[model samples]
Target: MHDFSHCQIVLGSSSPQRKLLLESLFPEANVRIVPPDNPDELEFTGSKNLFAIMRQLSQIARTKSENVTSQLLDPTATYVLTADTVIFVPDDFDTYLVLGKPPEEDRDGVVRAWFLDHYLGKTHHAMTAICLRVPGGTVHEAFVKTAVSMEVASEEMVDWYLSTGEPAGKAGGYAIQGLGSIFVSSIQGSLSNVVGLPLRETRELFERVVQNGDS
Candidate 1:
């Protein structure tokens, strides 16, 4: 557990990966995972309008952060963090088909096979919307983007990876931090963004919020 003696930060995500990233980055800070309040129907559009998408994501992140603040936080909490992740491709694609974590890991084999046949030789954008609510009750946010390329994975190879169950419950049907890294031909931006959270930008936003906070 991280030390919460001084300040508090609540992470608005139930994802294990996001929580892990927070723990790794703020070893001496307090952290808690809060589920997203947005409905499943809420869509995240990213990397196209860049600015527009980021603005919208910041809004959503702010909304989610405020939800956490109003629902599950203490009066002393110094910060509340929320994030949203999205994947973009050239053509119309399935989000669950790409990024949704499976209900049953047994489907990982099928998912890997499907991904191997389709995602090879393609580059896609991974966008993360990170929001931080400060002690003064204001929201600070940022959008992080990363381009990821998948190699030509064979069906047998996909099946092998699927058997390992790494694709289950992972966004874009793969885990960049785990065995899924093998299929990545290249990553043009923040590698951690593809994994889940973008620590660099998130931290910068936090610093800005703290520095410019209402006095």
Candidate 2:
């Protein structure tokens, strides 16, 4: 198993997929769970620059790490890990259509339908930013970008997917690791990123932290 014997790892996310992925990666380590008191709320009204998106995601992960760390009994012996994922689709106007979890306000199928109508049979990028707050207060971070091609779905298929109530809290109104997998044509990068974490990069980051005695 991957070595992280020196640190008490706390995963700061509520996504089941994220938890499962982390558990599979560090089966030997006892990873704890600490969901954020408040879910992240990002405003998507600006330009979809890659740098800007990465920065925002990194900041969110950093904040989550800090928040989770504050709750630990001994912050000096814990490592809090957090992550955020976003779906990026470029529009025809030389801009991007960034998608996160559908806002709580869009209870109707407006947002969900919009995503399915446009994103189905299209190419998009899924970016995930991960951060680890070491016991020494040093934060290690990384971002992974994956190119995903979605399959074209018929109206009935789209309706069925939406009816499952799985898209409400997912980026791009879909989850690649669940029933949503059937809607994906191909993925060119880290599948774990689309699932909400980048396994390879996350493991490498943890190894570096352990090697440097940051944990």
Candidate 3:
């Protein structure tokens, strides 16, 4: 395991999953939470093209990092990390649709429709963009995509899952690490990516930033 005992991580998202993951990844480091000033500023609505979606995710993460870093009184003493995740489903026209967190208004209706129309018995990509700003203002950014396949869920199953209220703030209207795990039949990439942050990729990014900073 890479040692981060001497570093401090300033998380720029309010996501509980991300916070837990970061703590697990850097157990010895002091992790601080500093959510973006304007959470809504991370909202992205644009093209469905896979490449375009990837670019947008990266941009969103970078913007989030900038927003949070600006609030830090001593950024040079800590690493600022920000990330964004989304679900992308391919459409009939060879394009993709980006699915973000379910809207608060009629969240149940929205999640129910997502399960019936897009997720159950289908495969979708969970993409997470990570932006890590190391000391000295150097920033490293990357995105990871994981293909998640869901089992065919019956109406009753969907209703039961919805009752758990676990999909409200999650992308694609599901949380793979929670009760929603019962619906995931298989996954093709980083499981952490589906949860929110890609552990291996994120670790590598942090290491690269630190190495470059040292050299």
- Put down candidate 2 lDDT per residue, 5-90, tens digits, no spaces: 55567899988889989888775357888888866556656746777787888878888887788778887877788998888888
State each model's C-alpha RMSD to the native.
4.6, 2.1, 1.6
Question: How much does candidate 1 score in TM-score?
Answer: 0.78
Question: What root-mean-square deviation over C-alphas does model 1 reach?
Answer: 4.6
* Residue-wise C-alpha lDDT for candidate 3, range 66-114, written one tens digit per residue: 8999999988888899998989887768788888888899998988988
Model 3 weakest lDDT span, ten residues long: 39-48
Q: What is the TM-score of each candidate against the true structure?
A: 0.78, 0.90, 0.94
- Which candidate gets the maximum TM-score versus the true structure? 3
lDDT value, residue 163 of candidate 1: 79
TM-score attained by model 2 = 0.90
lDDT (0-100) at residue 50 of candidate 1? 52
lDDT of each: 0.70, 0.81, 0.86
Most accurate candidate by lDDT: 3
**Deviating ranges (above 4 Å) for candidate 3:** none
- Candidate 1 regions exceeding 4 Å error are 1-5, 36-41, 44-56, 73-76, 92-99, 102-114
